[model samples]
Target: MNIYKQIKSEILNASHIVITSHKSPDGDSVGSSLGLQRFIEKLGKSAVICHPDIAPEFLFWLDTSQILLMTDQPQEVTAAFQKTDLIFCLDYNGTDRIGPDMQALLESATCKKIMIDHHLNPQDFPNLAVSDTSASSTAQLIVELIEQSGHENLLDEHIGTPLYLGILTDTGSFRFPSVLPRTHELLAKLLAAGVKHHLVHEVLNDNNTASRLRLQGYAMSQKLVIMEDYHVSIISLSKEELEQYDYQKGDTDGLANQALSIKGMKAAIVFTERDGMMKISFRSKGEENPVNVLAAEHFDGGGHANAAGGMSKLSVADTLDKIIDLVPKYFPAQ
Candidate 1:
C-alpha cells in the first residue's frame, strides 16, 4: 500500500489515537496537530491532541482546550499516551524534539508511530514517516495527505483555517524559499474552502497584546546588539526581563527573524534565558550560511537551512558568547 493507505489503515485500526508535535508548539506544530486530529476524527476514530508543553497566546483563536498539554496536565497526558495504539507525530522530525519526558514515554509506547515533518536530517525513529525538508511546512504536507487520502471535501473552513495558519507562518507568509507553486495551489484550495486569508494573517500576526508590543520595544531598544564586523545581530532576554514585561510563550516568536531585518546582517540569534537554561533561536542568510548545520554542530539544535533552534546549558551570557565566537568561523571576515 501507498503512504496514504498506510496512514488510513492505522487510523481505522486504532481505538485511541494520540496526535502530538514538538515541544514549544508553533503554528506548524499546533495547527498540524489540530488539523490532523480533526481529519482523523472524520475517519470515525476518537483522536486527541497532546503536546509536551503549551502553545502561545497568539494561537488563542484556536480552541486549544482540545489540546492536552503535558506541562499543565502531566498525568492526563501520560494516560493518553498509555492508551494510545496509533500515534501521529506531526511537525517534528524526532521524538527528542518533544522534551525528555515525552521522548521516554513515546519510546516506550507499543503503538504504531508515524512522523510528518518538513525539517532537515530527520533522525532514525518512528515506524513510518513522511519527511520532506523541501516542503513549506508540515501543514502543507497535511493538506496534501488529506487530499491524497480522498478526503479533500473535509478541507472546510474549520480545518482550512488551522492548516492556513501552519502554512502561512511556516512559509513566512509565502516569502520563504520553501513556498512553491504547489504550495500556492494548496493555499488556493484552502481559500476556496472559505479560509479568510486576511483574517488568518491578522489573527496570527496582528493579534498582539499591548504588553507584548512594549516588550518588543524594550527588547529592541535595550537588549538588541549588532556586531558590525561579524555581520551579526543578537538579542538576549532573561527570565527576569520576561516576567517584568509579563512574558507570554509567543511573545518572542519572530524576534530572531526581526533581528535579521537589519541591513548587512548575515545571522541572528535570540537567546532567551529560561528554567536555568537558555533557549536559542538561530537564523542565517540562506545565500551561503546554513543555520541548521551551525546550530546542530555548535548549539545542540537543528531545523531548516536558514531557520533552526537550539538550547544551551550554560548561562545566558556564556551562550551568547559562544554563538558570537562561532559566527566568524562560519562567515569569516574577508
Candidate 2:
C-alpha cells in the first residue's frame, strides 16, 4: 500500500490523537490544525489540537474552543501529549518551531508521528513525512491528504473553511509565486463542498482592530527605513512603542509586506523588541532576492525564499544597524 493509505491506517488504528503546529501561530498553523482535526473527525475518530500558543485575536472567529494551548493550559496540553497514541505535526518543519517546552514533550513522546509541511529541509523526526517544499501551504497538503486517502467524500464546510484559509493567507491571497494551477483546482473542490470563501476573506482581512490599524500606521510612518542602495526596507519597533499602541500579537503581521510594496524595494525586514529578543520577519519579491539565507546566517532563522523569520539578542538600535550593514552583502544595490 502507498504512504497515504498507510497514514489512513495509522489514524484508524489509534485510539487517541493530538494535532500540533509551530509556535506564534499564524493563519497556516491555525488553519491546518483545524482542517486536519475536522478531517480526522470526519473519519469517525477524533483528535485534539495542542498548539504551543494561541493564535492572534483576528483568528478567534474559528471554532478553536477545543484547542489546548501550552501557554494557557500547560497541564492539559501535557496530559494530552502523554495520552495520545498518534500525533499529527502540521505547518512546521522541525520540533524546535514549537518552542522549548512543547519540544521537550514532543521529543520524549513515544507515539507515532506524521508531518505534513511545505517548508524546506524537513527534520528526520516523523514516522511518516509528507513534505512538499513546492506546495503553496500545508493546508493544501491537508486537502491532498483527504483526496488521496480516499476520504474526499467526507469533506464539508467545516473542514474546507480552515483549509481554504490556510492556503489563502500562506499564499498572500494567491499573490505569491508559489501558487500553482492545481492549487486552484483544489480550491474549486473546496468551493463545491460549500466553503464560504468570501466569509473567510472578510473574517481575516476585515476584522482588524483600531489599535492594530494605529500600530501599523505608526510603524509605517515612524519606524520604516529604506536602504536605497540595496533596495531593502526595514521597520523596527521597541517594546515601549508597541505598548503605547496597545500592541497585540498580529498587529505588525503585515508591516513587512507593506514595506516591500515600494516601487524599487526588493526586500523588507521588520523586527520588534519583545520577549527579551528582537523578533524578525523577512519578506522579498523575487527569487533573486531570497531573504532566508540572510535570516539563517545572521539571525538564526530560515524559511521560504521570499519569507522567513529569525531572532536577535542584540538591542533594537544595534539590530537595525546590523541589518543595514548586512543588507549590501546579501542584496547588492540594483
What are the clashing pairs of model 2?
Answer: none
Encode model 2's per-residue lDDT on 1-334: one tens digit a residue: 7788889999999999999999999999999999988888889999999999989888888877778999999999999999999999998999999999999999999999999999999999999999999899999999999999998888899999999999999999999999999999999999999999999998888888898999999999988899988899999999999999999888888899999998899999999998999999999999899999999999999999999999999999999999999999999876
The residue-by-residue lDDT of candidate 1 on 143-240, one tens digit each, is 99988877898788888889999998888788888899999999999999898999988777778888899989999999998888888899999889
lDDT top scorer = 2
Candidate 1 lDDT for residue 68: 88
How far out, in Å, is residue 240 in model 1? 2.2
Candidate maximizing TM-score: 2
**What's the true lDDT of residue 40 in model 2?**
85
Residue 211 shift from truth in candidate 1, angstroms: 1.7
The deviation in Å at residue 133 for candidate 2 is: 0.2
